[model samples]
Target: MFRHKGKGRRYSHNLKLASILSGVAGLVNITGVLSVNSLTTNVTGHFAFFSEQLFLKNYEMALIYLLYILFFLSGAFISGLIIEWTTKYKPHSSYIIPLSIEIIIILFVGFSPDLIPGISQMIISSALLFAMGLQNALVTRVSQSVVRTTHLTGLFTDLGIELSLLFFHHQKARRKQINKSIFLKLMIILCFFLGGILGAFTYQHFQLKTLLIPVGLLLFALWYDRLLIRYYHIKRKLR
Candidate 1:
């Protein structure tokens, strides 16, 4: 049934994975946005544009931004569909499929940068955005939304809110809530910024080949998840 409970000690690993995934998302997004002038992960900016276009009666731009919103929603929807379809039968392996797909796309982008222009930069941007959304949604679901790896505006806001609450309201429940929220938000923000810096440097030096970094991170995540599953299985058997 994949029940999620936040026992302080138990959530550490999930938090770690969330931070790493957030960093990967940030790097990939910055790479795509800088290279193509299109956002690859978060859709907040797209939605804002859509709203402005609607107000200004710019139907053409509105429709374009609306498509971007749909694409992002489609990604999350597909990820959830994958999880729902597989979780009842093979719960442990569902995330691997999306992660694998993302890796392949990234590798293709790295190897054939010209494909972006040939297919139209918008299409390439949408593909990367979809992949990022899928990855972010999967991680968020797995962590029970206690962690979100993409979209830093909310994260930063949450961090500030939590910090303020921690000092203003020292009640146990308030303190605990603030602590957890702040920790997760700060971890995500820091990781994403670090990733952005690394991505910029890598792009400066290696250009498109910098895609390898995200690919490597995904592979590492897969390996780590597999190890955790194996360890849990062994412990269950011993018990």
Candidate 2:
């Protein structure tokens, strides 16, 4: 799925990529809130909480919230750096490296509770935010900004604009473009909702162990991408 770019990238590829990643993201976001008492998927809500805490003179929590935002940014920065470093020798590795890093981080996070106590929600929140940040960055790069799995604000905005074009646009080609965008965006949104349902249910029963669910999904993406690429190379050699 990460192998193509621009016009070479297909709607089918984007749909699969968005659905799986968005579903995993939804699981992480809700599960993080349930486990850590903070949202891990996006910084917008944290920024609001930071402002509120600042106004109330709760300086300690305000700083923690500020760290939440920074950690998320740092994760993106780190992933971007890895991409740049890998692209020097293997262009495709840009996506692979960041993705592999994200998977490792998620693994650590999933099992961190084994040694790390549950008393520090802030620490756990930052870890999950970093993982999310890495994922959001990786998806943004691979999709060339066509999709973002972690947040729905911009997706909904684009959906609204596309819906407008689909209904009222005069140009046939423009309408076709709008139609494709709407379908892919809708699939991502619905898949995310489905992920949340799964996360909530798992959390209710298994508690923090629910973190393992997303790890399994992410590993699937990693394995699938790598194996598919390898298969293509072998097929090309035979030709």
Candidate 3:
């Protein structure tokens, strides 16, 4: 799912990608809220908070909010840079660095909360935002922008537009494509919701350690993809 791009990609690949990554985003989103009372998956809310602070003349708080947005942007920038740079030499495994970085960040925040001062809020929130930014960029490039796992604002908008298109008459081919898109979007939303529920439930018992669930899922995705690649090569050789 992560390796293929353009015509090499397929509906099933995207479906699986959306399911796993969206779930990971959901877990991170909920865990961030529980840990620091901030939306870590996207900067939409942070922009509003920043503007509000500026309006109230709270420059210090506004600067903090601005930093939150910058952290998310930096994550995206660094992930994209790493992917582009590595794609030149290692196209198949270009995603590894960013994905691994994301996993490590979440694991570090979860495991060493007490080791770092102010881990409860600022640091944790910034780390998660950056991690999510990495994930969002990685997946966007992986799927050629066909999938977005971190936030639902755009998903809902796209879903609504596609649903309305269904009401209009169209060619059979276009209709089939639209149906596939709707299914993919719905899967992303459903998985994200499920992940959030699991994250919240686990947080009550495990606190910030709840992030381990998403990290485990991501690790499984990595392992599963590698296994699939080996199986494909073996089958080709046998043939």
Most accurate candidate by lDDT = 3
Q: After superposition, how far is residue 233 of candidate 2 from its true place, in Å?
A: 1.3
lDDT of 2 by residue, 107-126 (tens): 67777778675647777788
**TM-scores for the candidates:** 0.86, 0.94, 0.97
Better of 1 and 2 by TM-score: 2
- Give candidate 1's TM-score: 0.86
What ranges in model 2 sit over 4 Å off?
none
Per-residue lDDT of 65 in model 1? 81
Ranking by TM-score: 3, 2, 1
- The better candidate by lDDT, 2 or 3, is 3
Clashes per prediction? 0, 0, 0
lDDT by residue for model 3 over 97-195, one digit each (tens)? 999999999999988666675554778889999999999999999999999999999999999999999989489999999999999999999999999
- When summed lDDT is taken over every stretch of 10 residues in candidate 1, the lowest stretch is 1-10
Clashing pairs in 3: none
What is the RMSD of candidate 1?
A: 3.0
lDDT of each: 0.77, 0.85, 0.94
Candidate 2: 10-residue stretch with minimal lDDT: 110-119
